[model samples]
Target: MSSSFPFPIKPVPFMYLGDNDRNLPDLSDDEFCDLVAVLKALARSSYPRLEAVPLALNAYNCNQGTDDDGERPWAYFYPITMIPPARLDEKNDLLPNYPEIELDFEVCQDLKRRWRSIRYGGDDNNNNQSMEFSPPARYRFLCFIHKHRIDRKNTLQKGVHTISIWDREWDELIWHDTYHVDRISRRKDIREFWRHVKAPGFIDEVDSREHFMSRIRYRTVYHICEQIEETLRGPVPPRHTIYAVMSTALFHMNNARDLQVSIVPDRLELFGGQHKGLLPRFFAHLLCLCLDVRPGWSRARQKRFVLQFRILERLQWMRLRTREYLELHDSDRDGEYRVDAKKKDGGGRQWMYEALNIP
Candidate 1:
């Protein structure tokens, strides 16, 4: 006989079941078919009654939390087709269809070992109950994407798309005592139970106004001031972004900062009522600095400055429109008046041309 044994050691097929499998060089048609057959067999053997429908094969890079060796794990996306476990309904009719099962798999060497060693569907200690596979990180990500898409589509169909604010703290406060209350006690003290409860410690009247102010004032100068300083360090300051500026200003006001005067309850209501809280005050301060307006200016002068600003804004918009029209005319001979018989010509275009004194 030959010096070598009849069978040589080979890498476990399950370990290579990922996107990297596509990069495997020059396989004949038979070899490719054989590989797929092996994968199908492995999938079927792993989970009885489950059919593996391959979608995509790719290597998944695991983050620091998931990866042990920093090696990119081979990954595959497949829909595991299966019927729902039989359940008896009131009418004794089985639900015909269930939701599709999609899974992202990371092909790992350890997984192959675990797969082989673990005995499934038996009284043995190594049965499926005792041994289970930890889901890949991408599995959660995929689930989130599916859920988000469904929610977004449903929300869009309803026509009102807006960010929803959830006051978790307030919600917790409402339910915290109510959840533990005995039924009889709750029924007896229903009104007083909800109404007599004290507000949150931070906003409670137990603390003197001066004490509250002092506490919030120090917090603002320390925490908020440091954050603002850090944000202003980069070449493009965070304040340049409108959202960032608004958020920073809001944070300061929320923490009861003395921007000019103490942000008392009465002052808060006054500023917040018609102007939607501290935004107008913050905006006014910003505008003053930008326009180099003095703090001592009279209300009449301030109104005049605002009027002038509005006029300047209108002029700027007109100039922009004229420039855009000239550029479009130079680039295209037909400009906005391209011949399309199906399209209706409106008076808006004629009005624009007349207003801009364009032929």
Candidate 2:
């Protein structure tokens, strides 16, 4: 289905006060409270039907200790619930579909010295209290965009047009590039870098390297075409999947002597980072492409299509094996009198010529 939400999702800004040396903005308690209030008001204005606007604050310690003292809640925001509009006559108002916003607070004791140095001689609270307010190491704000399945049949669309939050001074907050979740290309690059660095010995063993290279020769081309087809149709595949397919395609294309595909490391580097089940997903995409099938196709249709191609490919390989066996037997008997037919047919025996035509 086509996306109901607009392409290129905009980034939402979150205040950060991590590095004192860099002169980052300090989000004071009053300022933070003002920001939260503004965000809540904005959400209500845009989506009036919201029943309860829940916001969560999580704290992370850079230097984690074994003690549970670090896990205590450093700060809290009052719970805000909106009154549900009462229905009049027979008409009912539509409910708000806004996603919950979560703010993460990275608390580092190491940065406290730097923070104190930046705000030297600041007023300190001497009130009688058992606990003291720990200085914030860093602040990150996160807002989620709910994945909505747009139905062309429905006349009314749900969700906000712009994903944004305003600061107290009425200035529109802007997100840094680091906070952009929709940066698929950037994410891919990070993934690839981690993968290569972590798996330096992935192709070290001779037998494994040979096996991987041999399988990729037939599998890579088919996978690339499959990915292209998916991309052409609506609902683009996941970034990770696309990266894996493209990476395999490039690797095989570079190694394959007959194929005219070229290498672009800049592009391939996107698929190389830390991710769950990355290796399996990589191999799975390769296998699916090799079989010329996709996830959404009917099981029966996929079986028929893939099995037919597999049978044909195996038969062709078997034919080459039989021809080789016959030639070997003939050579054994001829004893230096055999014709140069095997040498002449070497060009025609190339497996890619037949395999490439399957998909």
Candidate 3:
């Protein structure tokens, strides 16, 4: 060991260098020194004012363990060890993936104001309705299945049950000719029924948040029915049947049980008083990076990969090497640094040492 370097040079762990159980070849003394030389160069370039230790490049220090300076020694010595090059490309979802949607200026402003009010440290107990605006007609329609507790898949598909529920709830609609029908013909019958009938006046009025939400649902169901009729080359579907299908689509889109009916139109350009139209796309990119494919890698490996990315992204690119190199000499050594070659906890795990055959 030299006086300039604080820690003594240590050998690579058997799992990474030995050719025994895992069929990995052992590194010769000369090869080990060469690897240390490369790491030394990296550390020196990273921290021009700080000295580096040969022991920092050892297998035990190869993971996220920090030196006395409270800095990760290996991170500065070999940046790629933290995150492989293949995974770096997906770290950013740039401006291209998300495009701005055009919207009414007044509605867009309203949406923007609402999104802004709840950004940082707001009361969680606050009513969501106050923070959220009344959704458009189309978005409102999705809520119908929820409010009425309709069985979209079964009850709505079978028009008889759906109409019975609607007739019971509204009473004024006066649904007739329902003595022994199990299913109403989806095409001609629905269209003919709508031709002579209309929803009650209260259905269209938005006196309260409930009314507002209901109105949206009704409008959206009507839109879906119209689309079905035009595309199916027949008649509009009864609101009940279409509600079932809409609910199913909503479930798939949200991919959750909470069933979020509120839709933030993409056209809104500001949020929390900041330009936010493309903010979601940026987060989407980050999510992709964190959830990148690791094929057979364990959860621990995936977590370390994400942690390295978060740390690296925040630091200055030019000083990266310096910060890592200084940790080698700036930190104190407690004992002979060693790595448990067979540890399965995933912490301080090396990539080359991974079981490649794991399925």
Candidate 4:
């Protein structure tokens, strides 16, 4: 690690040089030392290419498994790893993740702040929630990648800038993680500030923090939705588990349930409802529910998914007045509301006779 770096100390890189690269045969002791010599020279100075950090992080650390090795997202020195395996590039929804990186972000201060700034984070806690964040809309992005080994799958490509994995090994890096990161950065202030020009804080200061952070949170949801649409290379994204994404986004932020809703738009376009605008931010609520998605959300996402099958299903479960409203309606005829227009052969229109007989 060099002392003359731009930011902090070079994060420690977890060392595990073994048979990570399959195509290239295992390095001979001499070759290994040569490679190490080259890397040690590079690490002796500053390499602040922030643009390429995440890719490196993804390749070296991000993945789901034991955190013993710093290979987790937080502890990578050099970014390039062996090329990802071939089964990774299957789809955009499944962002190949290095669980270590993902977990690392969860705890790092700066990275945590950055991640918290995303729409997914705004729905995590009620204490940190505000009156300005918009309820996230429901979306459906595919999850086509999930590998047995995510670490080795992050590297092994030619280009250092864009995703540069081999054609055959493209499927090895889960596209979902990459897609989301790319999509979110598109809405950032320094990089993609223009995308948020019409968002909550685009105008005057709504509240104290001038609503700056809140608006950032608001734009995140939009970014997520739009990105899925674009990155999935589609006219529309696939049907995700509905509330699953919404809840996940909110879980990241630590926001309140109802308070965040105050800021969230109430609907989303699921499949054919893109133009109708009847899509309620049930997706937003899903986020509120996902903070503890383990067992708590056991039924929530499923319930939201089922509601789309029938409108009445939702109104009944979430609304208290549905049963009362239903009881007042006429069941004998095809009509679905309170009985008042029934006119018999005897002439006059009739109301519920039970109420009249109340005397």
Q: Write one digit per residue (lDDT tens) for candidate 1, span 131-250.
A: 453221111111000000011221222111001111111111111011111223322232222222222421232245343323321111113323444676522221122222122223
Off by over 4 Å in 1: 1-75, 79-94, 99-112, 115-154, 157-359
Residue range with the least summed lDDT across 10 consecutive positions in model 2: 161-170
Which regions of candidate 3 deviate over 4 angstroms? Answer: 1-122, 126-222, 236-359
**TM-score for all models, in order of appearance:** 0.17, 0.19, 0.18, 0.18
Q: How accurate is candidate 2 locally (lDDT)?
A: 0.25
The per-prediction CA RMSD against the true structure, in angstroms, equals: 27.6, 26.2, 26.8, 27.1
User: Over the stretch 76-118, how does candidate 4's per-residue lDDT look in tens digits?
Assistant: 2223222222222445243322222122221222221211112
> TM-score: which candidate is best?
2
Candidate 2 residues 1-359, lDDT tens each? 01342321111122443432212233445443443342232222222122122221111111112232222111112132111222224442333322232232221121121121111232322222322443321212111111211222222442211111111111112111111123343233222222222211122211253343332211111233234446675332232232333233323222222112223122213233112222222222222222221234554454444332222333343324333332332232222212233565433323322332221
Off by over 4 Å in 2: 1-134, 141-145, 150-359
- Of candidates 4 and 3, the better by TM-score: 4
Ranking by TM-score: 2, 4, 3, 1
lDDT of 3 by residue, 279-337 (tens): 22222222221232123556566545433323222223313322223223213322111
lDDT of 4: 0.25
User: All candidates' lDDT scores?
Assistant: 0.25, 0.25, 0.25, 0.25
